[model samples]
Target: SELSEIHSALKEIEELESDNAGAEAPKNLAGAIKVQVDRVIRAYRTLLGMSGHAQEVLEVGENPDEEWKNVWLLLRRDLQKSMPRGSELEKAWHEAFNVDAEVAFEAALEVRDLAALMLVGVRYPFAPAALRATKASADLAFAEGQRALAAKGYSALMALEPFQSVSRQDLALAAIKGYLCTRELGWRKAEGEFKSWIDANPAAAVLWGEERKPIGALLLDFEKAIPSFDTLELQLGESLVSMPMATLAGQPSKAEPKNLETQAWPSLKIKGPLSPRTSYAMKNLLEVEVSPVIPTVTPTSILVNTGEALYGFDFLSGKSLWGDGVRLEAPRDAFHYSEQDPNLILTAARWQDLVIAPLENPLSKSTDAPKAKSSFGGSVFSHFPVVRRALVGVDQASGNILWTLGGQYRLRSDQASLPDLEKRIAVTSFFTLTVVDDVIYALGTTRENESQLHLVAIDPAQGKPMWSVLLGAGQGESNMFGNPMRDAMPGIPVVAEGVLYVQSNLGAVMAVEIASQRVLWVSRYEALPRPFTRIRSTAYRKVTHANGAPILTRDKKGNLLLIVAPTDSRFITAFDAESGEVRWRTQTENAQ
Candidate 1:
């Protein structure tokens, strides 16, 4: 009963903290909770000889990726043991922060007692002084043109690993600065890598480009501030693609676009009822009122969840893989299944978060431009639906919730009271879950100067974001699928040859360098629609969802082609996968 009560207390505390992110908790209340937790731990330890035990986190290793992952696990442990709990620095970490990168570095720099620290026998580990101070020293070296010392310092800092958003901020700074050091030394291959780190990792560059606070805003970059940059959309050539869809190298036209909603399967029959709400939004088919949103669908079975429940069947044999369906908090579009780890099911969702949808021409210079949404008739034209989801891993064999991401979720990056941390929702819900080499690549909508999609690669085991960046345009708005809900998201990111091919429903396709998280090129095939295109229902305007999924394949000569053949259009357009160059556009047999 004490353990159960402790769990309940933690949940209630999370809810209270969630209600007021920018405020301090009542001191008495916090003290009371801490006492209770201590009492519970003491009792459990005395009675049961242990409170609990988790699988030991993997140690930092030779693999850079693994080191990045295990960094936080060890960092949290070190910080707890190293820092005096009630110190001001520790308190600063408890609150949400947006401190300047230079300021933090300077604080570490101000610690002029290296001989004293040496007397304390501290090594280059995750301890605050070692991490922050060393990183600061390296940053100062870079700023002062001490390339050799900075390189060594950054290398040491990189090896230290980090835990929580704050230390991670330092780690990211160290990585980028290290890359700069490498570039300055004229190591060609390593220079590209350093530059790529700055591009792929938002924390390393765009988000931290300035020496400002909030430098540690990793996953909490829900409403990021953006400078007004051109969005850098690529242009498609006037040339036409001569190849037809059916004749494309690896794509079988008849076997493709085969869904229960779009096409009928004569041999397949619906055995029984599934979700209470059968229909969902599909970016490819804006013409249709609704479509299916399953995270994992294979030739043998389909796995779908709407925060209510989840299950799939071995269709060929009519065997239920997820028999009773695991109950969920809400329906979700993201799901991860790996052949390597077949027993684990990873799902992430966000519930009831705030989003300020950009109005039509809010920056329009002309006074006569439309200001309809935020003006007099704004209320009638708007609808606020419940937005909540969860980030969790389920046991595939038992249909059970195995682990959750936030709010007492052990693998958390930090113990801060983040508002939407537990919900784990994205800017755009994951349409398709992507797991490549044990890393999950997912999308979120960012509301900055322009509507742009954000990509974050996460480690499912820890629920920690490895890196993040802007994928392309058509973000933070309802324009993608023209849905009334107006939830922002980009196209499903399809990864091939270290390149992620994403088709934003608003007439654009972007190729992102997966390894670096950089947008190689973005080609806009159609014009972007005006804001509020859906509710206004303007007559005869073309919407971007008329497109199909990205088809990536290399010819015998080994040239990759990113092809798109819209259902409403007769011509099939092809872009050279390597360069985003328009190859050709030719008419198919069925011309509209």
Candidate 2:
């Protein structure tokens, strides 16, 4: 009955296409046809939701109904040709995942849906080694003297293999190219293809000589064939741990013994010194400020924070690719150092398909009476309003804002609340968002009284809050006349080994277990009196200046060390990463 109903809808669309033979397709009529197609898609999606579909997804031996299979094939064909991209249609397309993984993959490939094919590949248990079958098929073709067809098959199979099989697949591709080289005209084509491969995989390409190599040699230690981690000249800031790219690509890394003394201070070539006034101010500011530059590199791109914006740059050219592209306002001062630093204000975490970052201004703010103060209480950007922040998800390809998490921040309820600095501080808490294991850890504070810190966990895939844990009270209330706690530099939150290390301006270092959503250990370094006033008769209040991100690294013995350096203090403490036991403590001057 449902099959007939779907066919009837399909017939209606065919009739509409016939009617539009000469003139343009009418918009209203097209809309009506879309409604019918959507009905069939919804029905198919509903069937996919049924428990029967679960058998087709998880149990390979159990066959799906032949009638249902044919029904889906017809629906898929129609949808692939006419269905506009929409959430419902996408959901329906995703439902094509089946127990028969090979068939499912072919269906997706036929539709040119790479995303859907990837989804099916992940869901299919045998898809990782699906290349083995293709390899065997190509071998048969090659043995039968079908050189052209076999070469084409080998190229297609190379495209399908996972990264782990990359070495083996490259060898397979080399063999096919070798076969092409034996022919007179095909030698040029083979040379061109080899050059292309060499460009893409220079390290892997080096193993092969200018002439073709035996296919067997192509499998020569893929691990060693890959480039070493040292190839990337990543500029990780002082007190940072770097991960080797090869290790992340599933290659085992040998732990090289490092001399801590020599590694501590990198050789420096100073251009010159700042002016006396500026130098003095910088020294004092450096004591309380921690400028962290977290760099993430992909094969094609490099991402870095320049204090003003999160930038994606072309890997080879070092030219700017795409920026967060969020501009606050026109700078009043010639320096352009306004309420928004605009240089390194945004931090980002890269996931599978999204670049999640802290949305500095979570909500739209009023532009009428714009006013922003610099660290020295001087007007940096003239007439620029204070921009508060929240978490925003950006599309990796287009660098567009896909979704935003966290509440919108409006400094003033109306024009009258414009001067309320307390509300401004509450709405804007220093946050460092880091992505690990497909989850985004948002370490910051909500715009609330008492200025309590909020650590939120978000699912980057759907841009939804998974869980949240409240930490220590923020650097306390704002002091208008005295040293404002908001201006105090915040320690960046670092995520490593499934734990988040965050230090607030209040001088508290917390190790939070991300999965458990609980504090592992809290190390409070120091605290000072709040309101920052000297009143012998009044009650004593204290505040902290521990606002920089903690650094995590492994020592020579392979024991993980969590380094906590408080911005206010000259001392840095090292703790055992797993047990939270104090390993060592050293003064910043002595250590550096």
lDDT of 1: 0.43
Candidate 1: list runs displaced more than 4 Å. 1-290, 293-301, 304-309, 330-383, 386-392, 403-428, 446-450, 473-488, 527-548, 567-570, 588-592
User: Alpha carbon lDDT of residue 209, candidate 2?
Assistant: 49
* Cα misplacement distance, residue 463 of candidate 1 (Å): 2.9
| Cα lDDT tens digits for candidate 1, 372-475 | 23445332223212122234566544555654432111224553354443323322233234554456666554333345456667676666666776665543
Q: What is the overall TM-score of model 2 with all chains considered together?
A: 0.42
Residue 358, candidate 2: alpha-carbon lDDT? 62
Worst 10 residues of 2 by lDDT: 272-281
Candidate 2 C-alpha lDDT tens digits along 500-578:
7766655567788876888888776644433322221111221122233566777754477888765455667788877
Candidate 2 ranges with C-alpha deviation above 4 Å: 1-294, 306-308, 323-346, 362-386, 411-430, 481-484, 487-490, 526-549, 553-559, 578-581, 590-592
RMSD of 2: 21.9
Task: Give Cα-based local distance difference scores for all models.
Answer: 0.43, 0.48
Predicted structure 1: clash tally: 30
